[model samples]
Target: MRIGITLTDSRGPDALTRLRDELADAAANGMQSAWLSNIFGLDALTALAVAGSQVPGIEVGTAVVPTFPRHPVTLAQQALTTALAVSGRLTLGIGLSHRIVIEDMLGYSFDRPLRHLSDYLDALLPLLDGEPVDVRRETVRAVAGLTTPRVGRVPVLVAALGPKMLRLAGARVDGTVLWMTGVSTVRDHVMPTLQTAASEAGRPPARVVAMLPVAVTDDTEAARERAAREFEVYGTLPSYRAMLDREGVTGPADIALIGDEKSVRARIEEFGDAGVTDFVAAAFSGPDAARTRALLGELATAA
Candidate 1:
């Protein structure tokens, strides 16, 4: 399994610089990939582009960028531009963000999200592959007049959780970038669904990249408290709450990987056994960034 680190876009003032430094450090420490989250701060693609120049070898990816905020053509163009700038080292992870965020926050109608995503990927994939895209659908349409640098084809990953989306991801996209899903969920639910879909579709088994909160410390109690506080908002969110409930976890502490080196390593192995091809550790809230980095470094080396 490939071991990676997730750069948190949720905090710090010099986020871009910090992300660059972290990627460089991770690369130096022999980590295979580094992923950036698309939450409220710096855009994931832009951050990856900036970090790509700084760290040459490590694979850089977006854990996800919401699809509702941008059209398929626009997103395809942006992803291609970033891929070109990075010399084809970008993985574009796209998703239909939750209804509450789309409807309540952005004031966009949330009906037919699955259809929207299907249409978006159909239009967007051809564009990324340098094929003329001329498709008209209710939610998405693409007129193929634009040209990209054609550096290389950027791999599209779907941020998928449920059955329909996971099936779509297996059939259409390269992989799924999963968040807030535990190993049990991945083993019992996600892997089987994706594998079956891929097998039925006659495609290679879809990559399952698991993103989780990780805090490596002997003070497990303190780490759990910090994780619970840091992930408070996610615990309250409807979609994530449903996933947590399915995992039988009531709080972030239940999901977070917190312990000494041995225990953390065991948790990572558990994820691997559960069929995660890649593991991206988003270190939990803490005072010492260096300590977190060191812990990741140890894991990377040991693995």
Candidate 2:
């Protein structure tokens, strides 16, 4: 399996520099990919452009950027620009963000999310595929000029969870990015649904990219505490809650891979056995930045 690291979207003064250094370190440590999560912070594509130039070898991807805030045409243009700047190393992961964030926070109606996503993909896919897109639907309508340069084969992944979203990912996207989902969930719930859909469509099996919090430490309690604190918000999110529950976890502490090297390695291999094509580790705890870097390096090599 391809292994990677995830940069947290923490909005602190040192976040950007830390992300850059992390990407450089990840590339140096032989990681195949480096992913950035877009929650409520800096633009992911812009960060990718910067990190891409600095780290020449590692693939740069967004675990996801929400589709509700921007039009599909605009996103396609932005993604293409980032892909060009990165020399075709960009993976554009887009999604319909949660209703609470879209409707409650952004004040946009969350009704008909699947339809909106379908319409958005219908227009966005062609634009990314180097075709002129003139699309009209109930939610999104766009007419694109044929003047823009095309970045060939910019892979688009989707943050799909439910049946409809998984079907859409199978039908239209290169892969699915999953968070907080355990190996069993992937084996029993996600993989079967998505793989069946892709098989039915006569397409290759969709890549299953699993993102999990990882901490390598003999100090299990401290590591779990750090993971719990960092991942607390996800536990409360309605979509994630059910997944967590099924894994017998109430919070991030319960789900995170926290233990000594042997235990962590075993946890990671479990995902591989569950048919995960890619593993993105979000390291959450250590003695310091140096220790965290060291652990990441070890995991990269071992992975």
Using lDDT, give the best candidate's number: 1
Clashing pairs in 1: none
Off by over 4 Å in 1: 10-13, 287-292
Give all candidates' CA lDDT scores.
Answer: 0.84, 0.84
TM per candidate: 0.95, 0.94
The residue ranges of model 2 lying beyond 4 angstroms of the native Cα positions read 10-15, 288-299
Measured on C-alpha atoms, candidate 2 has an lDDT of 0.84
What TM-score would candidate 2 get against the native?
0.94
Q: Which candidate's TM-score is highest? A: 1
Locate the minimum summed-lDDT window of 10 residues in model 2.
288-297
The per-prediction CA RMSD against the true structure, in angstroms, equals 1.7, 1.9
**Model 1 over residues 90-164: C-alpha lDDT tens digits?**
888888878778888999888988899999988889988988888899988787745888787788899888889
lDDT of 1 at 269: 90
